[model samples]
Target: MHTRYGSINREMLIKRSPGWRWIDWEELSHYRDLLYFLTIRGIRARYAQSVMGVSWAIIQPLATTLIFTVVFGNFAKLSSDGAPYLLFSFLAILPWTYFSSTITDASVSLVQNSLLITKVYFPRMFIPLASALGKWLDFSIGLLVLVVLLFYFKAAPGWELIFLPILLIILFIVSVALGLLFSAMSVQYRDVKHAMPFIIQLLMYLAPVVYSTHTIPLAWQKWYVLNPMVGVVEGFRAIFLHHPMPWNWITTGCGVSIVLFILSAAYFRRMERGFADMA
Candidate 1:
């Protein structure tokens, strides 16, 4: 059978390669608005009916900081690297909370938004990325509380403050990478949803969130930097508590984060082709 348009009749065959690319940047860009809306929707859904609303962000880190002050600061006698114990613990908790929360949400973002996944053709990566974005707003609010603590303590960041944004980007990279990897896996195995919080809780102790890295033996320091958040939590305290930048930890951690991001992106891409079907 032949169909004619105007004066011409033609038959065309279209084909797509069997293999998928790590990312379709152009395709994602076309859906940027969708990403923004998803992020906004997430934030709203979180606080829409809450009594405390956005204040929950501040309360979470603040409450954790208070507990850590009693448990680690007074009882354990861990040094705060110069700043008061409250500021130090909160700074560490700041990034740690952001990282943990983002990862937790991203891990289940695909499952939570199964309806959207089933109905959409956009980049599946957006689900995890949008999950991260929602948490960034909470992080920003918690950061303001940190600044208030700094002023209350009469503390200010040194020249190393210039590296604050870079450190946050590194934190974001690692969190998003883990989020992508786990979110994809969760689509196939529902257990990731249940275990994610416990995993984050265990990671908090291992990553130097409640104590300075100075206490860890020098011999084990390099091996400890293998946890990317070792760079993030410590780097956060270094900048916020007005201490020297730990170049060794930061560099190694950043490198590891980049590598993980690349690997996770590839893995997510491979798994995402079946996401809508699985979801």
Candidate 2:
């Protein structure tokens, strides 16, 4: 009887080991309230007492669309794959702005919250996640502008519109992946802070934001898709402009991006233990 009790106790311990030894999913769930609060805090802090408030969201992307329309649409005579210049540029800019801004903010979230890091014991992931989530507000506003532009141009989205949400989710994941990777690097190297803006600016031109992917040679298209954003930008145009979905490129880019996200997340968690001390 005593031997039976010992074996049963051993089984109980083994069953409980996961809860004690590994990632505590339940613990994270319990902190859902905390995540909600942090997300709200980030949103409020962003727009607090700003003159334009949420309207800044619409203005930023709208202004970029206008500039691109002049430079690329008029002077450069860039082909927009039969779509109106304003409509073409606005759709691409919407996702680009969201990705760029989220990446920039998330990469610095920990450093910017150094005080909170030093003082508190919440999950460090919350900082970047909250920053990324906050940008959705801007994305939402930009989306509204896109709809208005479509109406003014008398253009209706094609059947490919069904894929827009999926493409946006992929873009979001890509942005967060890159953000976490850089955020981890930034903790160790301050130069990344200074380099980020220039890097993003360069990436913008490299992406098909102001022009169509059709401009690139067919032979080189596969290689260009390796840029990841190549697929995203093209995919956005395909959906919004009634072009065929770049399925092969989108698949390649989304697959690579998802892997990158997983790897970057692992790296972040591994390094996260040291962040409180380092920050």
Q: Which candidate leads the pack in lDDT?
A: 1
Give the distance in Å from residue 95's predicted Cα in candidate 1 to where it truly belongs. Answer: 0.6
Q: Kindly state the number of residue pairs that clash in model 1.
A: 0
Q: How many pairs collide in each candidate, listed in order?
A: 0, 0
| Colliding pairs, model 2 | none
lDDT of 2: 0.82
TM-score of 2: 0.89
Error in Å for residue 260 of model 2:
1.1
Query: What is the alpha-carbon RMSD of candidate 1 to the true structure?
Result: 4.6
TM-score of 1: 0.92
- For each candidate in the order shown, give its overall lDDT on alpha carbons: 0.88, 0.82
lDDT per residue for candidate 1 within 73-112, as digits (tens), equals 9999898876789988998899999999999889998998
All-Cα superposition RMSD per candidate: 4.6, 5.6
